[model samples]
Target: MITFYDFICPPPQATKSGNTWKTRLSLNYKGLPYKTEIIEYAEIAQLYKKNGIPPAIVFPNGYAHHTLPVIKDDITGHDVFVVDSLEIAKYLDKTYPDSPRLIPDVEDVDAQIQEFQNQLNGAVIAALPVMFKASVPHISENSQAFYKAARVRDLNFIFPDKPISSLDDLQFTPEEIHATWASLEQGFDGLSERFGGKNTFRWALGDHITYADLILAGLLLCVKAVHGEDSPQWQGFMTWSDGKWKTFLDNLGPYLSEDN
Candidate 1:
C-alpha cells in the first residue's frame, strides 16, 4: 500500500502546504489505495533521521527520498518519489496516460504550462510571508522582526522570540490589511484578464485543468484561510473573469473528492 506522510499545522484547508490534502488529490486521481501518516512539521527532523518518510517510498526493493506524494509500487518494487506538486501531476500524467490529464499537450502547451508554473510559484512565494504572518494570532516583536527583515540576512534588533499567539495581532494593522487586500484585489483582477474569467470552463489557460489550476487552488485556499470566505477582499475576486475561476473548480472537484 502507498503511504503519505505529511505536516500537521497545515496551511489553509485543501492548500498545497497541506501535504496530506495535496497527496490525497493525486492519489484519488490515480485511484490508488493509500494510507496517511500525519505528523507535526516539527517531527520531520526525527522522521527524516529514521528514513521512514512516505515520500521516500520504501518498497520491497529499496527506499526513496523523503519527499511528499511518494508512491511505492509494491509489485515491481518501484518507489516513485515526486516532490513538486506539478511534477507529481506530470508523473501521474505519464504513468496513467489516460482519463484525467493534468497537463495540456506537450508540443502545443509546454510554453503556457511553464509560464503558469513560473507565475504561480513567483507570485505565491512573494505573497506568502505576508499571508502567513497575517494569519497568526498574536504577533510578537520577534515575529515582526522576522517578517520585516525576512528578505534581509538579519534584523538589527532582537526580542525574546516566541510563537505567535493570536490571529488578531498579525503584523498588519487594520489599515495595512485593507490596503494590502486592495492591492491583491487589483492584482488578481488583472491576473483574471490574462488567464480568462473565473469559472469560465477555461482553466488558467484555455479549457481543462492543469498545473495552473492546482497551484491557484492552493494559493486561493491560503488567501481564503487568512481572510474569511465572506471577506469583502475575496468576494469580487473569486468569480470575476465571467465566473471562469469557479468553473475550473467545478470541473476539478472530483480530483479532490473529499475536499469539495
Candidate 2:
C-alpha cells in the first residue's frame, strides 16, 4: 500500500492540491491502493524534510519549500519515499511494471509532454494567484499567512512594479484580479493550440490519457477545489475559458480517482 501526502483543506477531504493531484491522477490511473495523509500549509517544509525527501534539484513554483504529492510505500521489502509529482508518477510506473503508464512508450511523447507541462506551469503564473485569493476560505486560518507569503514570493508580487515584502503588503484589487484572469485565459488559449483543435482528440497528445492530460487535469481540479465549483467566480472562469476547462473535465472523467 502507498501513503500519499496532500494538503487538508476546508470541508474535510473536499479539496486536494494540484501538485498532489497530479500524483494522485497517476496513482489512481494505475489503480494503486493508496491512502492520503493531509498536511497543513505552514508545516510543509518541516514535514517534507522529516520524511527525508530532499529538496528539488531545481526549485519549482507554488511550493513553500518542499513540494507535496509524495508517496511512501514498501515495494522493495523496506519502506521508501518518492517526492515530486512527475518523479512520483515515473517511480510508480517503474516499480509497478504491469500498471498502465502515464507516459506512453511512444517516440517524442515524453519530450512533448514535458514541454507542454512546462508551458502550462509558466502560464499559471498569471491566474494562479487570482484563483488562490478566491479560494482562501478553504485554507486553515493559521496556515493562511504562510500560504500568502509563499505565494507572493513565488508570484514575485500580486502585481508587477509593486513591491510586496510580506502577506500584509499584498494587494489584489479588481483591476489586478481581472488582469490575472486575462492572463489565465490567454494561457489556456496558447495551450489549446497544441491540441490541434478541440475536436482533434479527447486527450492532449493522442487517444490515451498521458502525463500531459494528468498535468492539465490536476490543475483544473486545483482551481475547482479552491474557487468552489459552484461559486460565481468558478462559473465566471468557465465562461471566460469558453467552456474549454469544463470540456477538459468531461474528457478526464474516465481516468479520475473515485473520490475525485
Candidate 3:
C-alpha cells in the first residue's frame, strides 16, 4: 500500500489544498490502494525533516519549503518517497504502466498540459483573498497563525498595490472583491478559449481524461471546499463560462471519491 500524506483541515472543509487534491484524484483515477496520513500545517516541516525527506521546494531566498501531497510507495519492493503532486503523478504512471496513464507518452504532451495547469492556477490565485477569508474560520489556530504569517510575508508580491502586515488586511472591500472576481472570470475565459471554448469538449484533451483535466478539477474543488457548495461564490462559479466547469467536474465524478 502507498502512504499518502495530506493536510488535515478542521470540520466543514474536506481536503482543502488543490495540490493535494491533484495527487488524490490521480491515485483514485489509477485505482491505487493507499492510506492517508493527515498532518497539520505547523507540523509539515518538522515531520519531513525528522523523516529525512528532502524539501519539495526551494525558494530564491534559500527557504526550503516542505509541502504535502507526498507519497511513500513500496509496491516495487523498494521504499521510495515522492514529493509534489506533478512528480507523484508521473511516478505513478511510470511505476504502473498497466494502469491508465495520467501523463501520456505522447511527445510534448506533458509540457502542453503543464502550461494549461499553470493558466488555471493563475485564476485560482486571483481568487485567493476571498477563498482564504472563508477558510479562516474552519482551520486550526496554529494553521491560521502559520498561514497568516506566510501571507503577510509574501503580501508585497501577491498584493503589491495594497501592502499588508496582517491577516486583517484580507478584510477586502466590496470593490476589491469585485475586482478580484473579475480577474478570475477573465482568467477562466482565457483558459476556456485555449481548449476549444466552453462546452466544446468533455476533457482538456478531447474525449480522454489526463492530468490536465485533473488539474482543472482540483482547483475547482479547492473553491468548492473553501466557499462551501451553498455559498454565493461557489454558486456563481458553477454558472461561469456557460457552466463549462460544472459539467467538466460532473463528468469526473467517478474519480472524485474522498475514500482511499
Output the number of the lDDT-best candidate: 3
Clashing pairs in model 2? none
TM-score of each model, in listed order: 0.66, 0.85, 0.90
Candidate 2 lDDT by residue in tens digits, 1-260: 79887777777566557777788878888888888777788777787678676765444544436667678998778879887887887888888989988878879876887788788877786566566666567778888887777667666644666556754554589888878877877887777756555545457777777778888888788777776779776787676445666777777776676463
In candidate 2, what residue range of length 10 has the lowest lDDT sum? Answer: 56-65
Q: List ranges where model 2 is wrong by over 4 Å.
A: 57-64, 108-110, 157-163, 196-198, 239-242, 258-260
Query: Quick one: ranking by TM-score, best first?
Result: 3, 2, 1
Candidate 3 residue runs with Cα over 4 Å from true position: 153-163
lDDT of 1 by residue, 1-260 (tens): 65566544333433334334545566676676666665544444355555543444454545333434443334347655445566666766777776477777767676887787676554444344456555442223333443233322111111225334332344656877666666665555656655654433456776655665666776665455556679865666565556655554566677755432
Native-structure RMSD, model 3: 2.1
Question: CA lDDT, every prediction?
Answer: 0.53, 0.74, 0.81
State, as a TM-score between 0 and 1, how close model 3 is to the true structure.
0.90
